[model samples]
Target: MKPGSLLARHVAPVPTSRRWLVPMAWFILLLMLSAGMGQLEWLFRLVEPDVREVIYRRAGFFALLGQHVMVVGVASLLAVLLGVGGAIAVTRPAGRDFLPLVSQLASIGQTFPPVAVLALAVPALGFGTLPIVVALLLYGLLPIVRNTLAGIDGIDPDVHEAARGMGMTAGEVLRQVELPLAAPVIIAGIRTSVTVNIATAALGATVGASNLGDPIIAGIVNGNTAYIVQGALLIGLLAITVDSVFERLQPASQA
Candidate 1:
């Protein structure tokens, strides 16, 4: 056999585990294309000035995007903290009775419509980003809390018994054994919350927080499909990109 054929025969088929690379590459390409579209005005003047203005100048799509990200990021962080703590609280023997109640409450928050949340929050919190943040945080809480509870509860009982038998304190077992094992599942919950909030944060523009939704709302007022598509595409791309980054950050052993 030729040297190439011999090498191919001897080397076990190269593992196919790197499949994520293909999607990651495609995602990067799409992001670059979106960025170019976002800045199309500088490249071509043939497009009508008014259309260019609508795409770039009037709406401040990039600025609005940044605001939306900040709002979602802050809200997601807050939701994770609250959800994790709440999960821990309700899991203890003394707090066990309240677990279902807390879970139901969080579920209620998630079920509430973002638009309705915005409307109610705006009246009390007034304009700007506070109302938006509150709405997003509330809406994002359930998944994190539910996943946290599931992760902690799903641990093998034998492991817990072994930890206790080894004279480990409750806090030590939780900090060292339980949390490390549960980290992957908990992170999965956080990933879900972050992605969901990214889309929901667009509702902020309805209450004057100024996000990518600005163009979509304006487009509806003027019956402009292009404007709506541009805004929706940007928000959708942002969610996918951020979720991809988070997935990459997850423990490789778990993946």
Candidate 2:
């Protein structure tokens, strides 16, 4: 009966001091990795080498970093579109008949190994970014689809009934109520998908995709621990940065 109850129910709760924390932390993390990498040289050399080695200066850090981002970013975007869209579709009344089919198809990516996907795709797509992109895209779909299905389907039946009783159209209920309520869960799915793909995308370098994995693969091939440490450290930092950003991005209730 309160004037603001309806709005309050739908609006995401955010803490004032912490509302800007996630973005600021992400920016600072990126800035430190970008600008302060040189000052951290000793950390990259802590691993014992089989032979004397120089720092990994073979490729520009930022360029490889950029390419890595592009590979995972494109793949994640595609997965979100396909995964979320598919989940949304199956949850709808008209599309309920195909829910089983949609779910099974989404799971194939998880069951199939990324390496296998790349190996198979390379012949069709050639060796470059495309195969790996396809691999990452498939590998990342399971979480997104699973989480989306849970979020939307888990909504309280009363909420839908209330919306319908109020004469809200199906589209309006979905837009105004269902998605906002489910967004945090959906975002969590995306976070899982993207974070996993960041590590998985490194495999792209094995297929000549030129990501952070290049140093890692090269290190393995040459027995240079420094190169391995360098690549592994950067990839680890990148994962932490991405995870932190998503942590802050979660809905307040979810957070």
Candidate 3:
């Protein structure tokens, strides 16, 4: 028998379980370790004697979590609304002349540093969450706007023509057809906005808005590595959790 024929005859298909076992085992071990670390009250107390007081009595940790959520949520919401609207507007024939200009503006907003935007806004908005929210919103707009434009523009022109030929009103077609087909792409943009905003919102603490960044900045000032690690771990876990939840919500078809 030929070598090639002999090999093909003897080779057996690999099981799916074998393919997935290593990665799944590692992930499970990592999760167990992280949970154990998070639950180690004694370790936390030794590292930061005020951990319980800050997390519970003073409500600093929860307050920080809330601020982070609020800034990211508000900024992401504003970005989605403006981005979707701008995408629809620029797709129209009448708005073609302005598409490049609008896209350039959004790109500029993203290229400008969040810290710089926050610094500029502070004098006008003062020391609070407002400046942070504004900076996050500006930072978040480009991805959403670009994604929205691409989703809408990527739709088949023939589909639009067919809808019109069938006596479907422009509004009806857009509401029933375009938006649904583009939903996956738009949601992807939202996911990106959310993840980016979560990280950027940490900058708020620089302007005196309490957030996860508070611990990080305080740790830096006092040279406390434990505090920095604790804050970073919490922030990273929060982002991962939120991202995982969103991933679960996505349709299998989209995935």
Candidate 4:
């Protein structure tokens, strides 16, 4: 196939609306549950018969879900921009010398657990969403950086020559040729980063961030299984919904 056709292959054969059906379904269910948690009291009561209160009501579920999404969304956005930009920069001749240092730092970010990052950050940033965002951003960077580098580096050198031979400028080669071909891999990295951060964001509750994690932490503290179940179920649903969206975005060939 021609280089141009390679980019087209990333588009799914499914219709646009049809492609999103699965994610939309999951997202709707999440909204229903968050909005109507009280309706599930019988379900939770079965899970915790002895408990006086089976539902978590310190704060609204919908509000906590919004807080959770906001934290992960902000961190994931920052991670994608920095990770993709840095990867592209280091691959260029002018920035090649810094590649090793950047790679090492990204690796360190992945190796250190999010909880530890939170612990270190809380003192400096102080308890709240700021530290959680920073922790999630750092934690999410490695996958994106690694995959972006791998995607760009894996491109055949002949493709670059072919594009340049056609009078494409350096920026044009990157934008039209490099990024398009690399999109599948880069998207896969972002998918992983976002999903993992969704689950990890729950730890924010320990640091005073009012998120879905709040219920889980409170459940543990109060020995309330129902609360833990509610929080975990929502987080799992959110992750699955977001993951399905990314899966649709990825090229079928790569998937």
Against the hidden reference, what TM-scores do the models get? 0.81, 0.89, 0.78, 0.95
lDDT of 3 by residue, 92-180 (tens): 88888889988998899999999999989999999988999999888988988898888888988887876677667778777766776
lDDT of 4 at 128: 94
Q: Scored by CA lDDT, what does every candidate get?
A: 0.77, 0.83, 0.73, 0.93
Q: List the residue pairs that clash in candidate 4.
A: none
Residue 76 of model 2: what lDDT? 96
Q: What is the alpha-carbon lDDT for the whole of candidate 2?
A: 0.83
Compared with the true structure, model 1 gives a TM-score of 0.81
Write model 4 residue lDDT over 83-131, tens digit each, in one string.
Answer: 9999999999999999999899999998999999999999999999999
Which of the predicted structures, 3 or 4, would earn the higher lDDT when compared with the native?
4
Which is better, 3 or 4, measured by TM-score? 4
Model 1 regions lying over 4 Å from their true place: 1-35, 38-54, 253-255
**Which runs of model 3 end up more than 4 angstroms from their true locations?**
1-41, 44-59, 252-255
Winning candidate number (TM-score) = 4
Ranking by lDDT: 4, 2, 1, 3
